[model samples]
Target chain A: MTAVQWILENLPQILELTVDHLLLTVPAVLAAFLLALPLGRLAVRLPRLREPLVGGIGLLYAIPSLPLFIVLPLILGTSIREPLNAVAALTLFGLALMVRSAADAFGSVEEDVRLAAVAVGHSAAGRFLTVELPLAGPALLAGLRVVSVSTISLVSVSAVLGITSLGSLFTDGFERGIVASIVAGIVMTAVLALVLDLLLVALGRVLMPWRRPAPRRAGSREPAQVGERGAA
Target chain B: MTSLLEALDWVLTADSWTGPGGLGVRAGEHLLYSLLAVGLSALVALPAGLFIGHTGRGRGIAVVSTGVTRALPTLGVITLVALAAGIGLTAPMVAFIVLAVPSILAGAYSGVEAVDPQIVDAARAQGMSPRQVLLGVEVPLGLRLILGGVRLATLQVVATATLAAYVGAGGLGRPLFLGLRNHDYAMMLGASIVVILLAVVLDALFALGQRLLARRPGTA
Candidate 1:
């Protein structure tokens, strides 16, 4: 059968699997955002704490996901093993990106804006909420956009643990010699990634409407500059 | 020397390296796969990134590619690719390439963009063609940033390549994955140590490269 025919044949299974993949990815991102935002704020306030926290997160990020999945079963006693492990592993990696971005967004708030807030007799909390956060909104949203997209892509690996998702379709498709399943999975994944990215860009625009559109042809130098500052 | 030799001996011993089904591959296979992933990633990401950076017309393409590529976890991408292509080294290698491309592209594009506009104007005024301006002016200036991205990509690829062991693609992760499966802490620790060592060494090399690149005249 043609690829199109195969897709049509297994559309329900493909959609179900795609939804399962989103379930795995979406929650991990939300959990990460919840954890990261506060931690990022804390990191900014106590600059000294930033290094150890970021370093720890970086170390966690470096751990191979497959190994982490394998290790999780041992620690968690294999009850709800696969999904739990996937969540935990993805959470750990997501933390690194989320925390980094949160800190960066907060840091990117202009000093002059903060000074202006202070001049108006704004308390520290007031300044952060009104001045810093407003300015940093665009950058933070950009970071979130990045994190969300990344989470979607990484969710496929959860399939290794028998957690059904688009990845499972891909694995099952290839393994079972079901050409339709494979095509369905790849198409579904690519579509999911594209759709999610557009959503993120839209979210960024909504959250930071005051920010100008990103320079169309700006080089990658800004991230490096940000990295240097963050590392320092 | 004795202690180091003993550690080396421990790593090379049959039990430490053997697979469950007696189909265990050599450490060299692991190294080969890692190298292949890194090499392919560099080859694809660097040029594409440079082209995107220079062209300045494909912002949407660049952004979307980086976003999608970065989002997909190394293991997930590899697993999916493996499923489509069949499990083995090739799938993981392709995934690693996909994984590595975004950072490199982002870096290259940014590096080129970061170049002072005046330099380009001067080069143009001096009768340099667009090719000459790119090759002679922009690329040299952007080299450090591009290198920085490559460094980051290399580190990421090496660390993530450990996942390849899951599909029977050999690497240092084999023992770690197997140890996790069998509850073998000694094996896990040994494998983890090797992976950590690889990361540290690669990181150091990149750091050195960054320093050298920074020191080049006119780069700053």
Candidate 2:
């Protein structure tokens, strides 16, 4: 059957798998982001912690996803078939990547701005929330975009472990020689990643209303440039 | 703890170490695939990236392609190719090369772009051709970041090459998928341990190489 016809007939299964894919991805990315924020800040704030923190993260990130998934069940005391194992492994992968970006994001905030907030009698917490976080918003968002895309793609790998994500399509399709289902999975995954990326961009706009598209002129810096630089 | 010990026992078994499907043979296959992919990818991506970075053109292509490729699921790529190619080395190799190209491309361009503009101007002022400037000046200075990209790509290929087993191509993944099929967790864990060790050892070697390159007089 043609790939199009195959997809049309399997739409329900496809939808179910997409939901499974998102269930694994969204939580993992969110948890990684939330946890990475503090860890990244500590890395930046404590010079002593910077090397080991980032270095260790880089080391862990180098582990293959399949192996990490296989070994995680043992480490987390979860059953081999548990989806939680997939989520935890993905969180580690995402967190490993995002921590460096998070550090660079917070580090990108100017010292002058922090001092200025302090000079105006803002408490340490207040300055971080009002001055530092907002100023670091663009870079953090850029980092988050990478994490989200990566997590979304990596979710499919869990299907091989029988955890059931869109990746299941690939494994099942290969077994049955169904090219269409595999194609559908690939398209759906890319679409999910694109939609999430756009949503994050929109969210960034709403959260930082001051950051409009920079006017292109001889000297004006482009906002898109910031996003590029922030990515690894 | 018991499973971990079982996995260790599996690894230590002489039978698991010597056969056609043994860890040594599988690991050699994995290494061979990874090296070919990373090497071929660098050959294609490095010059293109250097050109873009040096000329300050096609930066958009680099950025967009990198984002798109990064979003492509590794499993999907390998499975699809393996299906079409009839389950051989071709699919995994193609997928690995595809996976590695963007990284090496991004690394080469970014490394060159990160070079100080004043230095490029100094080389140009000395009447050096663009080729001479790129090779003699930018490449040497940017060697650390450039090699950093290769290191990352190599590691990625090594890790992903395990998927070759899914397509009936041999690698350490042979035991992994075999264990999965037979419900052998110890075998799965054992193979995974070897894969992880390979990655770590290669990573350490790359780290050492990067440090040595950095120590060269011109690189810093």
Candidate 3:
């Protein structure tokens, strides 16, 4: 049968696979974001710990996913299911990216701004919440966007461990000689990535309303050049 | 020897070619696949990226295309291609090429765009044709950024080429994947070490090359 005919026949299964794919990515990102923020804050305050923590995270990121998955079962016990293992593996990877960005975002908050908050008799906690986080909001959001999309992609690797996600479509399709399954998986992955990226861009705009939206272009146009200068 | 010890002996044996382990054959195949994929992708992406980047009309499309390509999971792309093309080194090669292109293109396009407009105008005023100005001034000036992209693409491809073993395209990943299949912890660890070492070594080499190229007279 033609590719179109095949897609038409398996529309329901394809949709289900797409949903499975989303499930694999979304949860891991949420988990990573929760863990990374505080860890990032701790790393910044300690300063000396930052190097070791960043280095350790980078080392973990360098490790291949497949072997990591194989090894995890030994440490965590064999009873751990595929989805949890996949989530754990992706969480480690995503944390590496998120932690550094989070730290950098927080670090970039102007000292003068923090001093101003302190002059107003704000407590330490109050200053962080009102001054630092607000100023660092855009960068932290950018980092989250990157982490979200990266998590979506990494989840596809989880399929190798027999986790049922959209990646399974590729595995099943390849084994069964079903062309539609492969196409369906690709189209779904691409669409999901696009939608998530747009959502992140919109979120950036909403949170940083004072800052104008830069032209969505291929090369990095400096924020200053895009006429959004000094807003940060 | 115990089964575990025997596997260790096989991996550590210096002469992997005639030894029970498939290490030499796997490493050779892995390198070949990586080089071919990166080379082909660079060839395709450099020109295409330059065109799209220079045209200035399709910046949105170009940006989105690169982001989507980079964001797609490497394993998913490989599995999908392998499904359509059938399994082998070719499948992974095709996948890496797709993966490599967007980064290279982004690099090239951005490098070209980053070239100072004043330089291009100066060249044009000196009676240089548009093509001549692009070839003579823009490309040379943009070399560093374009090369930066190539370095990143090469590193990504080399690291990811380890996945080729999933489809029976032997590489260091062969032991890694097979060890997972058979629950052979030693083999997996051995393979993992080799893969990580190779990635780091290759990354260092590319970084060194970038430094040398950037420092070369008339290039910086």
Candidate 4:
């Protein structure tokens, strides 16, 4: 059968797996974000802690996914088939990526802004929330965009262990010799990643409206620079 | 602790080092797949990326391609390709080559792009041809970043090559997937430890080379 026909028949199953994939991916991305915020900030705050923390996380990324999925059950005392194992591993992967971005994001914040916030009597917490975090917002979002895409993709590997996700399509399709199912899986996974990324971009726009670029004026370079910075 | 011990025991056994499906064979297979994939991908991606970086053209394509490839699930790609191509090295090799291209491409182009334009201009003003400028100036200066790309691609390819076992292709993943099927946690852990060590050693070696290159006078 053609790919479209196969997708039409398996729509419900595909949707269910999509939900499962999202359930695994969304939380991992958010948790990594929350965890990395402190860790990234710490790395930025203490120059001495930067190397070890970032380096350790980089090493964590080097661990192959399948083994991590298999061995996590042992580390966490979870059952072999536990979805938590997958979630935890994905979280580690996401954090490995996000922490570096987080550090860079926080580092990208200008010192003068921090001083300005302090001179206006803002406390450390206030200054960070109001000044630094907002300034770092775009870069952090860019990093999150990457983390989200990768986590979504990585979630599929957990299917080999019988965890349901779009990746199950690949395994089942391969075993059954149904190319359509595999095609469906690839398309759906890519769609999900792109959609989530667009959502993030929208979220950034809504939250950081001032970041919107000014309309182009012929022969003017300043607005173009602002646009480039915003895009970055 | 017992499981960890069992894994270590499995790894340390002389029998695990010899014969078919042994660590030696599996690791050799794994490295072979990784090497072929990365080498082939670099051959394709390096020249293209370097051209793009030198001319500052086709960046949109590079950006979109890298983004799309980064989002591809390697497991899905390998399994799908394997099924389509029938059981053999071809499937995993194709998947791995596809998986590896973006990183090396990004590395080559970005490395070249990161070179100061002023330096390129100076080289040009000395009456050097664009070809000469690219070969001598851009390639040397960008060598570290270009290697960084290859390093990342190698690590990624090596990791993903483990999936070749799913398609009946031989690699370190044989022990991994086989252990999973048979409830052999020790074998699983042992194979994982090996894979992790392989990645680490390669990453460190790449990092050292990058450092040494960066330290060279005028490169930085």
Candidate 5:
């Protein structure tokens, strides 16, 4: 059969795999952000804790995903067949990456701003909610968007671990020597990544309404430009 | 804890140290793939990044490509390339090179840009050529970020190269995947420790290298 015919016939399977991809990614990214925020705050509040805490997270991020996926089942005492292996490993990675970003996000809040909020009789929690969170919005959202893209692509990787996310198409095509399937998997993955990226950008715009084009000034200062977040 | 002990014991075994699939050979393969990818990527990306940083053009390409590259799944790239290219190192090479390129590109360009413009002006005022300004003024100061890119790319490739086992490139991933297949938790954990150890060691070495770079420019 021709490539188009094969893809046409397998449309349902591809769509199902896309859903699996989404399922694996969404929770992992959400869990990552939730976990990373506290760790980031802890690192920042206690300056001495910053290096080891952030470094530990970066070290975790450095572990190979395949090995982590294989070993997590054992670590969690679950069967290799469980989807939790993929989710847990991915979540750990997502957290590892996002921690530094989150810390930097909180650090982006100026000390004067904090003092100004205090002058208005705002409680600490109230200041964090009303003042810091909004100012930190761009970095936090940008960090999430980067991690979300990373997670989406990684979810397909779980296919080799026998989870059959969008990545299954690659394996299926390779095993059968069907070029269309592999090509379809690549195209679909790209499409998924692009779509998800757009959604995240839109979400960021809605949440952070003040991020409009600004005039570039001389020596325009920017806080540390984290890796993979140049756009933000 | 018992499983962890068993894994530690497994790594100490003499049998595990020698054979076609021994940790030594696998580590070598992992190193080779990571080095090949990072080295090739740096070669192309550094010069291009420097040019872009120096001329202040093509920044958008670097930024956009980095995003797109980050979003493209590494596993899919490996599998697709492996299938089409028919196994061996070709698959992993393509994947790792693609994965590593964006990082080195971004790091070098941004690093150069981060250099103090005043310093470049000083170099020029001292009758230095543009090339001299780049090499003498920009590169040394921006070395940190340029090296940061390499460090990040190396770590990424080291981690990702484990997929070599899946695509027939033969790295440390063998033990982990085979262990999974045979339900040998000890072997899986042992192999993972090896991969993790490699990552930690490499990261430390890079950090040390960065420190050395910092020292050199200051002393000079």
Candidate 6:
């Protein structure tokens, strides 16, 4: 069948799966970020906690998702049929990735910046909120973008365990041997992921204006140096 | 603790190491699949990245490709390909290549771009060809990053290749999948240990390689 014809015919089903894909990713990534922020901060604040906090999560990230997905139901005493299995599995991965990125984000904050904040009569909590987190925005947002995009992709994996999502298209397509459905699923997933990534990039620009390139004159561009701090 | 011990006991048993579907055989299949995928990924990405980095072009392509590759769900790709190809090791290998190429490509180009221009200029002043400069200077300087990306890709492919079992392909995931299906926890734990151990070993081996490739600051 022609690709356009197939998409036109399956528009309703496709739209439903698209929603499923978004539902699988959006809340899970937010939950992971919520868990990761404090844990990532703890890793930075306590030198002794760094290895276990970061390394342990990294190890958890290394565990295959399919097994983890299977094992979560066993471990959590939840039914395999429940949506919790997929959500928990994706959250673990997002949490794992975000912890390291969050630590790196906070770590990227300069000592001078902290001292300056303190010198300005800011309390510890106030300084962290007003100075440190702002400085860490670029790195933190970069990490979030990665985790969020990968999470969107990973929602497809849960289809194997029978959680209906855009990935179900691939599963059902294969079972029914409908090549058009599989291609449509692949195209839709790719478009959704790219759209989400671009959205995060745009959000980063809006939220962290300091990270964006400055408006320049139409002519007379200067190549001052490679890798120099952007004219921030 | 008891489950851990039980898993170790199960793994140690001779029967687990015997037969066509034995742990040893599975490990071999696992290694072969991962190696093939990594090798193929490096082959495709390294050249493209090298050209882009050397010529200072295709940055957009690199960025877009990496982003897209990172975002495409591997499980979907694997099952779809497997379904199309009618089952074999090929599906998982293709999926691994897709998973791996972007990192390797990103690493290669970024590694090249990171080379101090003065070094390249020096090579040019000394009458070295562009090829010679790429080979003698940029590649060695960038080898660490390139290998770092490969190492990361290898770890990922090793972990995810186990999903081959979902499509009726064989690997270390067999025991885990079957064990989960049949309520054989020992088999699950035993196989998981093997899988994790393999991943750790790959990680450590690359760590050592990165160290060995480390050139002293004053020397090449």
Q: Which candidate number has the best DockQ?
A: 2
Model 5, residue B182: distance off in Å is 2.7
Candidate 2 local lDDT, A1-232, one digit each (tens) = 7889999999999999999999999999999999988888888899799889877896789899999999998889998789888899999999999999989999888888878998999998898889989998999999999899999998998888799999999999999999998999999999999999999999999999999997778646655443342221
Compose the digit string of candidate 1's lDDT tens values, residues A19-114. Answer: 888888888888888898788888887899998876668666655555566555445655324676787778877888888888888877777877
DockQ of 2: 0.58
Instruction: Score chain B of each candidate by TM-score.
Output: 0.85, 0.98, 0.88, 0.97, 0.96, 0.95
**TM-scores, all models, native as reference:** 0.76, 0.95, 0.81, 0.95, 0.91, 0.86
Better of 5 and 6 by lDDT: 5
**Residue A159 C-alpha lDDT in model 4:** 85
Candidate 3 backbone collisions, by pair: none
lDDT of 6 by residue, A1-232 (tens): 7868888999999999999888888889999988988888788888799889988897677666766775565567775547877888899999989999988888888888889999999998998788988888888888998888788878887776678889898888867877778888888888987788889899888988878676786654545444321111
The candidates' DockQ values read: 0.19, 0.58, 0.31, 0.55, 0.46, 0.41
User: What C-alpha lDDT do the candidate models reach, one value each?
Assistant: 0.71, 0.90, 0.75, 0.88, 0.84, 0.82
Clashes of each: 9, 0, 0, 0, 0, 0
Which digits, one per residue and each the tens of the lDDT, describe model 5 over residues A1-232? 9999999999999999888888888889999999998888788789899989888887887777776786676668876567877889899999988999999998888989889999999998898888988998889888988788788888877777689788899878877888888888888888987888799889888888899769898667654432312221
The list of candidate 4 runs beyond 4 A from truth reads A220-232
- Output the lDDT of residue B180, model 5: 69
Candidate 3 local Cα displacement, residue B103, angstroms: 0.9
Scored against the true structure, residue B31 in model 6 reaches a CA lDDT of 90
The alpha-carbon lDDT assigned to residue A221 of candidate 6 equals 53
- For residues B1-220, could you state the per-residue lDDT of candidate 5 as single tens digits? 7877899898888889788889888989889889989999999999999888877778888898887888777877888788779888998899999999999999999898887666666677899888887887778889999999999999999988888888777888888778868888899889988898898899889999898878884311
2 or 6, greater by DockQ: 2
Worst 10 residues of 2 chain A by lDDT: A223-232
Alpha carbon lDDT at B186, candidate 6:
73
Candidate 3 C-alpha lDDT tens digits along B1-220: 2443654575677764444446777777778887888899988989887776555556788898887687777776777778767788778888899888988988988987887766666777799876676677778788888887887777678778878988768778887777768876677766765666676687678768878888876564
**Residues B1-220, model 1: lDDT tens digits:** 3333443566667775566422146345655666676677778777777766666757688887786566554654565577667777877788777877788889988887788766776787899877787788878899888887887777777777677777668777676667667765556555655676667677777778788877989675
- Please write out the lDDT profile of model 6 over residues B1-220, one tens digit for every residue: 5565777899999999889999999988889889989999999999988887777777897898787778777877887788778787888888999999998888888787778777777777898888887887888888887777888789889988788876788889888778867777777878877887888788888888888778545212
Q: List the residue pairs that clash in candidate 1.
A: A150-B71, A153-B72, A154-B73, A157-B76, A219-B110, A220-B109, A220-B110, A221-B110, B30-B171
Candidate 1: segments with Cα more than 4 A from true spot: A1-12, A48-56, A71-82, A118-123, A194-232, B1-27, B44-48, B51-88, B123-136, B166-168, B176-193
> Could you give the candidate ranking by TM-score, starting with the highest?
4, 2, 5, 6, 3, 1
The CA lDDT at A177 in model 1 is: 64
